[model samples]
Target: MNTETNILNILGEQIKLGERKEVNFDVANLHTASAINVPIIIERSKKPGPTVLFTAGIHGDEVNGVEIVRQLIAKGINKPKSGTVICMPIINIFGFINLKREFPDGRDLNRVFPGSKNGSLASRVAHKLITEIVPHADYIIDFHTGSSGRFNAPQLRIVKHNQQLRGLAKVFGAPFVLYSKNLNKSFRTVCNKLGKPLLLFEGGKSFHIDNIVTNTGVNGAKRILFYLGMLSSKFKVSTPKKDCVFIEESKWIRAKLSGMFKASVKINAKVEKGDLLGNITDPYGKMNYFVKADYSGYIINVNESPVVYQGDALFHITKKLIR
Candidate 1:
């Protein structure tokens, strides 16, 4: 083997600077008496710089983020100018293959961070990510989408008090930025505890890909890399045409009655209180229940699925723009 290949032995895999290398992370599969190897891509730069990690498919059905990472790799993003870019296009491989949101064990991987080695499937996967993958990065981007049947306006969801993370969110240049509260056992919460800068990108919807959402994610990622001084001028970072609007609070409009939902307003539409957002009708179209906004804000997420149950989240509204 050559010198570079010899180095691969040290890293347990052969990878070269400016070239894409695939690493299969082994996770135990008890039922099959085998191991599930999650695929990871690492692209290193010849010059030294900070390492940034881009992860997608935390919810396996969210395909737009996965596509964003794939496009980045295909478009020569694998060749960084000064730093390492580690992309895990599909982190929830089991869930991705099953087209489900959670692991086969019915556990949400995002909620079980810094997990135990001998825990459940989700916990084990989380353990591997926190231990083997996340520690090597200076910053992290966890990509997501609205849950299945819902669509979100491309936005960055960050903590309300972290100025550093807030700055990074602006650099991401998403049209809408939400200062969201951290959830228990979430990746965001763990990162915050570790004092790592981790930003969550939410857009599009699960099980499908939208061009606009994918473009926003891809461009936003490039902008972040440029801001971090990882990409040189040759990469051509584009400036945002408009300023990002920040919202500190958001509320979800829920269905009053179970029925067939038909949305009248789309994602990113500005609305006033009592505005006609959508209507829920019975199966035979005999009864119609008009759903109205409870607050004056922008629509960041809307349910696209036709069927909904009573109390089901139908629309997500953010507070009026501050800027």
Candidate 2:
């Protein structure tokens, strides 16, 4: 072990690998009638060690994760170090351009896992990703943010069944952790089945940059690199609150009345059963309707936009029914 460490140190000191300017993993024709291929490459290290894959913009509008990946790539490139970083800063170029959640053909890239060779554009992207990259990753970090009309506190999303995922979640150093059992057909789901654990970090509601939440995410990924022995200590990391709620079941509370919304509760606020969450008021300022929680829990995500109609998802509350 000592000899290996010394060798790593020597190799690290002597390391010199230039970052690739372009790597074509798959071919695509641009809108200008020119043939182009999507680029994906690993910035390799001189020292042989673990390789981590950082991906973002699976849903183009979710910008924080992309920023996190881009920032890390820049850091790795500017300072050569141990291990390797394989990055794909923009995964969904179509959605990125359109600023939509789904692909150009309206396919959710997250749902099309281990995708087909001869399928839609989303499927082809997924297929190329899984085939060319994931198999080589020792650890994975995929970034995500809340979608349209929803706001989420910076948190880690992990499946309840996997302890490896849980361990990785702690490395993130976030205040909350959401147990999303609905990983079916998702990128993390397929990877878990293949024995490659991934941490799906979520924060900063869609289309908006929540500075506090984003910084938490940006710092969390950098902290993980240190914890994984991939980088030397360069900054002081805060002691993350381990007092996270283990929510096994998270459900959306629907608005019963059709009217403009008045959100009375904020994200991360705890509420008891039957507690008044907020209310809906008609445009005329009369005919007010009260919305209440069916179970006691904390508010992780809430509808930010005020104008809402009947059956609009108002709150995403998570109950600690199971540990």
Candidate 1: segments with Cα more than 4 A from true spot? 1-20, 29-37
Put down candidate 2 lDDT per residue, 84-144, tens digits, no spaces.
6667778887787678889878999999998988988889888878876777677888888
Clashes of 2: 0
Candidate 2 local Cα displacement, residue 250, angstroms: 2.2
lDDT, candidate 1, at 11: 27
Q: Which clashing pairs does model 2 show?
A: none
- Please report the candidate that would top TM-score against the real structure: 1
Collision count of model 1: 0
**CA lDDT of each prediction against the hidden true structure:** 0.84, 0.74
Candidate 1 to native Cα RMSD, angstroms = 3.7
Model 2 regions lying over 4 Å from their true place: 1-26, 34-41, 74-80, 321-323
Candidate 1 TM-score versus the reference? 0.92
